[model samples]
Target: MWKMELKLTDKLAIERTRLANERTFLAYFRSAIVFLSSGFAIIKLEMLREVIWIGYALIVIGPILFFIGLFRMLYVKKRIKKSYQNDPD
Candidate 1:
């Protein structure tokens, strides 16, 4: 009975970790979208002509954010897999 309880607890913890990981990825994705949209707006709007560098910077940052987020998600996934494997329960 104790072993069964431990297993159930471990399973729940793992599920929670996975959900948290997904939430983090979604947050990153949202940030990337915001960066991309802001970049587009700056580049397209005539008022931003005096400071076009900001727009280009945002455009460059958008993809960087996306890739960084991707890398973090994969890294967390691998870590989680390792944790699960190491768990005796």
Candidate 2:
């Protein structure tokens, strides 16, 4: 009975960790979309002819956000794997 409970708990923990990782990635994706959309809108609409640099900056930032998110997701996954190996219930 104790072993069964431990197995269930470990499964829950792994699932929770996966969900958290997914949520974090989604958050980053959302931010990238917002930045990319705003940049495209600014450029297409010519919203700020005098300060076009801002639009360019945002466009650059969008990809950076994506890469950062990807890196973070990989890092977290690795950490989780290590932890699981060290103390798997």
Candidate 3:
């Protein structure tokens, strides 16, 4: 296996990129949790009986959002790894 030698700046930049990716993933996870919780709340609460469909929609969307986020994070991480491995610098 070939390894790339990274400069301090390049290493720092990559670290930042990784952190940013993690933050984005966390945001997505948070949103998914919120949606799922809200959906459950709406479904269980007696007051929101009329809008049950909205609850179901949110429930469906929550997992989709989570998977999308997971996929994106993995894709970006893969791209970053690829770039670094192929780096000529």
Candidate 4:
């Protein structure tokens, strides 16, 4: 009798895809950070400081993008599960 068996489950089969997804998420996070920093800089700028709405809008947009990336990950996870569960025929 064999002590162990080697198999490729659906989740394991798509590991690279999952990793790519993670990399994409990190990229979005980087963009979000850049936007946040830009917003703070704008707030500190003498001439631009008066534009309170622009600063506030940028700050709000950064977090919204981050949350969108987070939700995309969740959506992809569900898609992966469904793909793995489907029958080939």
Candidate closest to the true structure, highest lDDT: 3
Error of 4 at 44 (Å): 1.1
TM per candidate comes to 0.86, 0.83, 0.89, 0.72
Clashes of each: 0, 0, 0, 0
Candidate 3 C-alpha lDDT tens digits along 1-89: 86668788988898899899999999999999999999999999999999999999999999999999999999999998877875553
Q: Candidate 4: where is the Cα deviation over 4 Å? A: 1-13, 50-52, 85-89
**In model 3, what lDDT does residue 30 have?**
100
Report the lDDT tens digits of candidate 2 across residue range 35-87.
99888878877558877777788999999999999999999988887666644
Least accurate stretch of 10 residues (summed lDDT) in model 2? 1-10
Q: After superposition, how far is residue 73 of candidate 1 from its true place, in Å?
A: 0.5
Query: What CA RMSD would you report for each candidate?
Result: 3.9, 4.1, 3.1, 6.4
- Between prediction 2 and prediction 3, the one with superior lDDT is 3
TM-score of candidate 1 relative to the true fold: 0.86
Pick the winner on TM-score between candidates 2 and 4.
2
Residue 52 lDDT in candidate 1: 87
Clashing pairs in 3: none
- lDDT (Cα atoms) of all candidates against the true structure: 0.87, 0.83, 0.91, 0.77
Q: Indicate whether candidate 1 or candidate 2 has the larger TM-score.
A: 1
Minimal lDDT window, size 10, model 3: 80-89
